[model samples]
Target: MNKKTIAAAFVAVVAAAGIAYWSLGSANAPLRGSSVAAASGNKVITIWRDPGCGCCDAYADYLEGNGYVVTRVDDPNFDKRSIEAGVPQQGIGCHLAEIDGYVVSGLVPAEIIERLVSERPDITGITLPGMPANAPGMAPTKTGTLKTYAFGKDGVTVYSEE
Candidate 1:
């Protein structure tokens, strides 16, 4: 090929690579939090997630849509933080959250969260464990039952099955 054709080909390849990189980077970028304050009676939930996981953002959206005021923080070391917050290694989820005084892990359902706040269970927090495909925010529609476990100074125990 002529010099101009070769140069054009190189430019095209470079442009394509740049676009691909930007797409991936933005996908993993930390999500911005909502500026709107929660209404008088709304519950406020703060979630910390790995910036590389898209599902965490979806989970935040799920919380917001369910009437909770959600705040998201992108922490690449979220798992370590979860452990530090008393979540067992085996019970770690994709994201970690603090609602009222309890730590919530993974894609737990909104109603369960509401129940936690209402029941005021004496525990450090509740977790849904690993990323279940049918869990809220993980899938469009939930199917089957999801067992949520509570962990605290005592130990991990079954919180509920929804």
Candidate 2:
């Protein structure tokens, strides 16, 4: 072959090799592994809430509507349990949830819960204090003035204004 012909063949070979490597890397790439249930298409989230709390049930329904297969535990000891689980009084909400490994409390929005699962922040959990009317499962009131807080061992801080 002429020198130019040989150079063209070499470039083609290099391009082919690069394409092959890209395809293999793409095929063997690791998944995000955010939700164990999402891998199997179940997308389940476990929740613990007070039995008599109507808003807690409403939150569960909202989660269910947003693709979470909710397993609710209505324990009368919800207050004690949340405290035991590291949820502070100032950070209290309507219910407690475990999504993947992170904690979710009160009437937090479904989108925020999804973000928590996806981002996996190094915190105890997220909370919507006092069940604001405009929060995910809370009753819609005039102002919708619920305050959402993020809680961890360090302390609680307001996360969002609802």
Candidate 3:
């Protein structure tokens, strides 16, 4: 099989798995409302991403496909913003996001983001450093890989094996 074919297969598989997980897990969970802004509802999420990045847009679409109402903010200086907001430089990535006071960076999986927001872990944010092509937005048309990192008071930790 060609590389694009493989990538499509992988995406399909991941999407299928994600849908199954969301269905079984959040099916009955109460949707957080506007009263608590930026909190996960069954419908929405707010993300701050670089203005010119196609990958960020693609990632937003991915979230939307998963039943998330993504509010995208175009920030040209996301790196500066992230640093100012206390995200560690070592944990920097292509994008930065905020959900109910929690931070998410780069090609973070929607499921993991959900876990972070729901659990409200004492952490700065999550990051997928260097935007590996296999990451949600960073995926190459053919083949690639990504590493997800979690930023906490203890420092950056590898959250997922990708």
Candidate 4:
């Protein structure tokens, strides 16, 4: 092939590959993992955290272990993202996660997170402030004490005790 023809073909191939990769793995794509229940349908959670935060990685692992399709975003502007997701001032945690129309602030357990999906509460979302001892992804403590709160424009209220 002539140089011009080869270059054009190469560009075409590259564009095709880029499009395919995006469609298959983009945040909006449907869940592909067997662990996720069909009811959830590729229920992926996108988490925004500080790049150097190790606990955030641990939290992501915990979610994956429970079958959640997780997407990790090490954003320098993570705090802005969390606030934009509507995290209450009192509910801010080490990391922020966005679920189906819900903002999860902090180290909430997979169970609580799943419950939010299952129950489909009317509130905006839930929060686990202060990386509670024994909270999923944090060092397990004997007390296992953590407080989960539900919050929205009306403000924050107790969601549950764990």
Which number leads on lDDT? 1
lDDT per residue as tens, model 2, 1-162: 999999999999999996665323221222112254544556667666777988888878887878887777767666666676677877766776666656677777877776666676778788876766667776542244556677887688776664
Better of 2 and 4 by lDDT: 4
Q: What is the lDDT of every predicted structure here? A: 0.81, 0.68, 0.68, 0.74
Best by TM-score: 1
Residue 57 Cα positional deviation in candidate 2, in Å, after optimal superposition: 1.6
Off by over 4 Å in 2: 1-35, 38-42, 140-146
TM-score, prediction 4: 0.72
Q: Least accurate stretch of 10 residues (summed lDDT) in model 2?
A: 25-34
TM-score of each: 0.75, 0.68, 0.68, 0.72
Clashing pairs in 3: 133-139
Error of 3 at 126 (Å): 0.9
List model 1 lDDT by residue over 51-77, tens digit each: 789988888898888888776777888
Cα lDDT of model 3 by residue, 1-162, tens digit: 999999999999999986665433231222222214444355456566777889899998888876777767777777877776667887777877766666777777777777777776787777766677666765534144456777777987877664
| Residue lDDT tens for model 4, 20-126 | 76434433333222223325576678777888988899888878877877788667666666676777776788887777767788888777877887888888788
Of the two candidates 1 and 4, the one with more favorable TM-score, higher being better, is: 1
Candidate 4 regions exceeding 4 Å error are 1-40, 140-143
TM-score of 2: 0.68
Candidate 1: clashing pairs of residues = none
